[model samples]
Target: MSVPAWLARGVFRVQEAAMRRPTFAMLAELERTQWLSRSEMLDYQTGHLNVLLQLALAHSPWHADRLQAAGLADAVRAGAVLPSDLPRLPTMDKRDARDNVERLVWRGVPGGVFPYTTGGSSGEPLIFYFGRARQAADAAGRLRARRWWGVNPGEREVYLWGAPVELNKTDRIKSLRDRLVNQLLLNAFEMSPVRMDDYLQAIRTWNPRAIYGYASSLALLAAHAEARGIRPRLDALRVVSSTGEPLFPHQRELIERVFGVPVSVEYGARDAGLMALQAPDGSLLQMSETHLVEVLDAAGNPAEEGEAVITSLVSAAQPFIRYRTGDVVRRSGRADPGGRGLAVLDAVVGRQTDFIVAADGRIMHALAVIYVLRAIPGVGQFKLIQHAVDRLEVQVVPDARWNDAAREAILHGLRARLGATLVVDLNLLDTIAPEASGKHRYVVSHVPLHGALAQAVA
Candidate 1:
C-alpha cells in the first residue's frame, strides 16, 4: 500500500516548519540587520555575549565552578564584561563542553532540543546540542552569505561537493524539494574529465546564477576544462563561492580566469556558523557580528595571531565559550576602536592535525601540496597522507587525459619542498571519498602534537 500524498506533504511541512521556526527567523533577521551598521554590530555582539554568560552560568557546571573559583561570579552577576575580561575566565575543551551540554541551557528549559555529533576528522568526535535559535541562526547565516554571492533561495545552484546524497534515503525527499525549490546538486566524487565535461555542459544548459562548492572539486573541474580546451561561456553565473577547504591564491586565480567570475572564499566549521568571507575587495573578513574570535598563545593570553579560539555569541543552547577551533590563523589587526568592535581574521591554515613535519624539522602546511598539485590538468580529487616523519602518500583521482608528466610534476614539487631524502608515493584511484560530515580533508597526518603551534593577540 502506498502512503497518501497529503501525508507526505504534511510531513514535509512539519520538517520545514521545524527548520524555520519563528525564533530562528528573528535571530537570522537580527544577524542580517546587525551587519549594516557598526553600532548595531557592537550591540549584537554585546547582546550575544550577555546571553552566552547567562547560559554559561546556568548550564555549564564547568564554567560556573571556574567562574566561582576565579572570584568573578559577582562581576558576571553585575553585568556583561568586556572582551578583555573574558580571557580571565577558565578555558573549556571540547570534551568538557560535550560532557556537560545538558547543564548548559537556561534553568528549567530543556536545552534547545537538537543533538549533533561532530566528525572525528581531528581525532575524536564530539556530541553537542543547540537550541532552535542557534540552528536557525546557522541556516540563516548561510542564506545571507549566499545572497552576498548573488544566490537566492529559489535559484538553481550547482554544488561541486565531495559527499554524494543517497537517493534511497529519507533525505531524498528533501533533495527533491531542494530541486523543486530550484537547487541543482552535483556530486564532487565524480570528477573525471568526462564527468566534468558533462558538468560543463550542464552549466551551459542550466545557466545557474551561482556555483557553490568545495574548492578542491571546483579547482579540478577548471583545470580539466582548461586542458580539454572546453571553455563554456559561464557568463550567466554571478558568483562562485568555495568552502569546506582553503582556496589558495593560485587556485582562486585559476578558477576566476577560466570561469570568468569572482571566486568568493568562505571559512566555517560544523560546530560554528559562518566564520569568515572574502570581501569584495578580496580581504578575508571575519563574521564578527555573530561570533567572538580570538587568537591565543600557549600561556592562554591572546596571541598576536596564531590559533583561533571562538565563542559563539548567538548560541544559548550550546554555549561555545572560548572553544578552541584547532585551526591556525593570522589576525588582520585589532578590532576597530571607533568601528563595529568585531575582530578581524586575516588567514586560516588548514587543520592543526594535518601540518606535516619534515626530516629537517620544517613544518609544511597542507596548502603546499594543494598549490603544487591542483595546477596540473586532469587531476580530480586528491589527498596527501603523511605516513612517517618524512614519508608521504599522495592520492589522486585522475581524468581520461591524465599522464605520467602530471605525476612527475607533483613528485618533483614534493621533492623540492621536502628535500631528496623525503620518500613520496603516488597512488591513483577512480575517486577520493569525502568524510561523513560532507567535507574533504586534503591532508592527513599521524604525527602527535608536541608543542603549541598557535599564538594569539589581545
Candidate 2:
C-alpha cells in the first residue's frame, strides 16, 4: 500500500474504535442476519419494526394518533405487531411528511436527530429527520452490499455524483475526512468530454475497487470513452454500481461493456434510506433488515405492480410509517437466487431525470435543479426546463401553498445553478401534464449536449 493508503487505514481503525458500541454492534449484527432463513429474516425485521413503532408512539404524537385511530395501537401495545400485519396502518405521502415534520420527529432520540432534505425525484421536496440508526443503516448496508461484490470498507472507491459547488469550511473538513476513508469524490454534475477523460485517468491512478455513480451519468461517460477509443485498464476494479436513477437496459449494456465489470443497481431514497441492492446473484434484494417494502396499487391493495410503500425500520426518529414513495416497483415472484433470504423485487420502473447544463458549462445531474425547487415550501409540484445554457423555464403547479416570494426564491436558485446572467421565467400552472410515457419528470433539459467537448476545451 502507498503511504497515504496506510495512513487512511490507520485513521479508519482509530475512528472505528471511537464509534459508539451500539452503532458498531449493529454493523456487526448485519453480517450474521444476512445469512438467516427467510422466515427468520421476516421475524428479525418485525422485531425492529415493533421497536420503531413503540418509539414512534412514545415520541411522535402524530404517528401515535394514527396507530391508535387505525386500531393498530393495541396490537403494538400488546407487543403483537407482526411484519405481515403492517398494512392495517394508514399510508403516508410526502405532503404529510412536509406539513407535519415537527410532529413526526422524536427529538430525544438516541444520538439526537439529524435534519435532511430530499432532492425530489417526483418534484415534491420533503424535509425529514433521522437519527444515528438511520445513518448507520444506510452506510453499513452499503458496506455489506460492497462485500457482495468482493469489496470491503476502507477499500479504494470512487463516487461519481454531484458535489456542492460552494463548500464552506465544514464541507472542506468533511472532504478531508472522506479522503482519509480512502474514498474519492468526482464531480458527476460536470461531465464534459475533457473532464470525463481526466476522470478516467484519475480512476486509472487511484485504482478504485468499485465505481459508483448515477445510472445515466456513468452510461454517458462510457459512451464518451468508447467514442474517444479510451479503454482504461484498471486491474483493481470489481463492480460498477448505478443509482439515483433507473438503469435502462441499453445503458446497463453500455456500462458493463465499457467498464469490463459487472453492473449492479441500487434503489434508495434520502427519506427512505437504503431500500434494495442488486445482489451478485442478479436478484434485486430488499434490505429487509432495515426496511419493509410493500407494493400497493392505487386503491391501496397489495399488488404485484404498484407504488412502493416503505416502512423504514431504522427511521424511528421520524417514522416514515407506510410512506408512499411514488416509486413504481414490481415485486418479483422469483426467490433470492443467492439464498441470503432477503426480499426480492424484479425491477425498479422509473424514468431517469435528464442532465442539466449550467451557464458556466457545468453538466449537473437533474437532481441539482430538483433540489432547489423541492426545498421551497410553496412549490407544490414543479418542472424545470433548461432551454439553453443561460436560460431556464420553471413550471410550477401551486397548491394552496402558493406565495409571491416563492417566485423570487425560484429565480435566485436558478441563477445560482445556471449563472447570474441566466434568465429564469417562472410560470404558475394549475396542472402539468405527464409525458406520452405517462411519467412526470421533475426536470427536463432541452439544451443539447452536442457542444460538451467544445465547452470543456474552452
Candidate 3:
C-alpha cells in the first residue's frame, strides 16, 4: 500500500527525532547555507573545520599528533586555522585509516560513535566509527540534492540497489521500513532476464517520483528495457540519480532515452560521506558546507586535475582530516551556473581500480593506456584487465580498421604507461563480456594497493 506523502514525511521526521539524528534540522540548514557567497562559504567551512579539529585534539590521539607536527595545532587551538593551512598535514590513505582506527576514533563523542564498515568495492575493507552527526549530514545532503530536481522528502522513490539477504527477519523489517518512508527497493544484485522483467513491472506499478542506483546498474536496466521495448510508465519521475561508479556519456544517453528523465550523477564514497551531486544545469556541485575538498597532483601540490582529498567537517567522532580518496577528478574553477555558491567539479574520472599499477610501482589512470588504443583506428571496443602488477590482458573487438599496425600500437601504448617490462596478452574477440555483477568497467585491476589491508577489521 502506498503511504500518503504528507503522512510519510511526518513519520520519517518523527523517526529521525526518535533516533536523535537531527536530520531534518540539518536539511533545513543546508537549504539555506547552499546559497552563501563564495567568501562567506569559506568562512563557514573554516569555522566547522576548527570545531572538528578541536574535537580531534581532545580525543583522537592519532590526529592530534599530526596536527601538532603540521604546526597548526596552536592555530587550531586559537580557532584561527584556515582552509589553506590544511596542506601542512600529510594526507592519510586507507591503510593509515585502517591501522590507526583505534587511536583515531572518539568513542565517547556526543550522540555516541557507532561502528561502520566500507563496502570494500576497492578490495580494501575499512572498519571505522562515525557519530550521529555524520549520519545526519549524509541523509540531509541527499535530501537537499533531491530537492534540486523537485523531489521532496517522502515522495515515492525507487531504489535499484543492493539489499540484505532475502527471506530473513532483517529483510522483512527493511522492506516495511522502506514502504513507511515511501520507497520501493529493487535488487540490483539479482538482475537475470526474468528478474529484470519483474523489476520493470514493479516500477510501472510504483510510479516513483525519482529513481536512484549505481550508474552501471541503472544503465544495464535501461538497456534491457530499451532492447525489450518495455519502457516503464513513469509520469511522476523527475530525475534518475546515478551513483557508485562514474556515469559515462553513453550510459547517460541510454538511461535518459529509456526513462525520459535527466540523469544526475552523484559522486560520493562510503567512507568519504556525501561529497557532490550534479545540478540541473549540468554542473557537479560540491557539498562545500560540510566538506573541504582539495585537488592535488601526484606531488601533493594543488592542481586543476588530480586525486581528491577531503575533510568531512561533521566527522568529529573520527575525523578524516586530509583523507586521500584514490579517485581522480578535475576541478572546475567556475561557480555554480545555477546561481548557487557551492564549488564545482569538472569530472570524476575514476577510482583506484580505474588506474593501473606498473611493474615499477608507478600508478597512472586507465586513460593513460586508453589514449593509446583510442588513437588506433582498428580498435572498435576494448577492455583492459590487469591480472598482476606486471601482467595484463587486453580484449579487443576489432573493426574494419583492424591491422597489424593497430595491434602493434596497442602493445606500444600499454607498455608506455605500464613500463616496457610489463607483459601484455592481447586477444581479438567478437565482444567483451560484462562483469558477473552486471557492471561494465573499461579497466579492471586485480591488485590495487596490494596487501593494503592484510587482516579483517576486528
TM-score of each: 0.68, 0.92, 0.77
Q: Write the per-residue lDDT of candidate 2 for residues 1-458, one digit (tens) a residue.
A: 22365677567667755653243466677888988998899889878888988888888999999988889887887778997788778899998998888889989987888888785566767778988888778877887888899987778888898744422334767777777888877877667667888998888888888999888888888877877887878899999999988888778887888889999999998888889999888899888899889998889999999999999988988999899888899998877878787889999997567888877667777877776787787888888888888888889888676787888888888788778998888898888788787777788888777633222211
Kindly list the per-residue Cα lDDT of model 1 for residues 332-443, writing each as its tens digit: 7655332333455667875422455566655444444555565665565567888886788888877655898888888897877667887888998877776674445677
**Model 3 TM:** 0.77
Model 3 segments more than 4 A misplaced: 119-121, 163-172, 352-458
Candidate 2 vs 3: which has more TM-score: 2
**Residue-by-residue lDDT tens digits, candidate 3, 239-314:** 9999877888877888898899999999998788999999999999999988999999989999999889999999
> Distance from true position, residue 20, model 1, in Å?
4.1
Clashes of 1: 11
Clashes of each: 11, 1, 1
Q: Rank the candidates by TM-score, best first.
A: 2, 3, 1
RMSD of each: 12.9, 3.2, 13.5
Ordered by lDDT, highest first, the candidates read 2, 3, 1
